[model samples]
Target: MSTKRQLAQQLGVVVGFDDPQAALEQYRTPPAVASHLIHLADLNDDLDGRTVVDLGCGTGMLALGGALRGATRVIGVDIDPGPLETARENRRRVGTKTAVSWLRADATQVPLCPDEPVTAVMNPPFGAQTGNEHADRAFLGTAADIADVSYSIHNEGSVDFVEAFAEDNDGTVTAAYQSSFDLPRQFEFHDADSRTIDIELFRIEWA
Candidate 1:
């Protein structure tokens, strides 16, 4: 089994969006964070021989991570075709034998119905932008519809919302960990050249 650090190194080649849309909160998920979450999911025996789907999969960091580890198949869904193109380039950059598919569709509305066990990995928008509050709820709803289990990254102090949503949807919060998102000044609104935001990772089992 590849350690987290090794997985990070493997995912280091993933490229970020060429032109990020502030409305979408598009950003490259840090290799370290992606590696840690994927590694944690692997530890839970959630990935191997399973269909792993990455929602809002900017440049395919998490999706590619799953492929590198031992997932039988990986599908990355995103609304932007630009990032999907970059994700295709990234697949070749991080050479692997596992099958991977990139679909240009909204994460919240992707038409996917996998027949095998499914695991979702997503770094969705935190709804920091105007008119987008509670954006993660749509993603969670889609996850509940598609995946058997999911690992998601969210803004800090999301436990109550996650837990309540889980309960309402016949799911359970199986595990949680504190993590950080290393963000860069890719958009005009960013005040600093770089910032590290404290975040939380949750593992939920959907029924």
Candidate 2:
């Protein structure tokens, strides 16, 4: 098994969104964060030969992580065509043999229905913008419907929300951990060149 830090180094070549949308809260997921989440998921037996879906897979960070770790099939879904273009290019840059399908569609309403075991991975929008509150809920809803297991990143204090939502939907919170997200200044609201945000990672097992 590769070290988590080693995986991060491999993903350092992935590019971020060219024209980020603040409403979507589009920030390039840090390589460390992506590696940590995907590494843990792989350790939990969620990646090998499984059908992996990366919801809101901006620039294919997590999606590529799944491919690199031997997911039999990978689907990268995002609403924006611009990032999908970049993600396709990143797939070539990484040069993984795992097959990846980049689909331009709303991730929260993914157009996928896999018959085999599925693992969904995402660093969804944190919903910091006005009127975008609870954005992660929609993403979770899709995961519960389509995946046997899921790994998601949320704001630091989302344990209660995630637990309740899982219980209500016949899913279990198998694991939870705190992590940091590196956000380089890309939008107008930024007051600094970079900021590190406290975040949480959750692993859910769906019924």
Candidate 3:
């Protein structure tokens, strides 16, 4: 547990975007959340000998954690270039030769390699911003199409919607964990220094 906490702290040292785009709903997943989810994946044997993708992988927390935990291959896809640059720097800092790939592509459009079974972990947009509403559906839909199993975080208020979406895609929620997602003040929208959002971590298996 101490090692895991240390890893999370190292990953968090990389700064997130200085100017986060609201249209993309860019918020970095907290270090604790990333560590907790990665530990759960390790227990499930999802990190070994598997190809993993981190959708909207801001600063590469989930992707790097997967690599550090022994995933054979990990891919991180993000639409924003700012965070992707930061993620690459973090990768070098981690110093793993795990064949991690970073792509500057939208999560919904990231292509999967045909020969490998893919598992995805993501903290997609909560769709709170005016134009980005329901954007989580796009990431979920893409994951359902490409991955055998997926772990994603969603707003607590959207549990029903997430369940229905999973069912619609021939997927089932095998496990769900609840936690508080920290949203720090990034943009100047006249908000507090930080706020916590109730969130659910979902583990889904695709049929």
Best by lDDT: 1
Q: Please give the TM-score that candidate 3 achieves against the real structure.
A: 0.93
**Candidate 1: stretches off by over 4 Å:** none
If the candidates were sorted by their lDDT against the true structure, best first, what order would they fall in?
Answer: 1, 2, 3
For model 1, how does the per-residue alpha-carbon lDDT over 71-96 read when each residue is reduced to its tens digit? 99999999999999999999999998
Please estimate how well model 3 matches the true structure, expressed as its whole-model Cα lDDT.
Answer: 0.85
User: Which parts of model 3 are misplaced by more than 4 Å?
Assistant: 1-4
In model 3, what lDDT does residue 207 have?
76
Model 2 residue-pair collision total: 0
What digit string (tens of lDDT, one per residue) describes model 3 on residues 34-134? 88888888888878888999999988989988888888999999988889988998888878788988999989988665468788999998888887789
Error of 3 at 128 (Å): 0.5
Residue pairs in clash, model 3: none
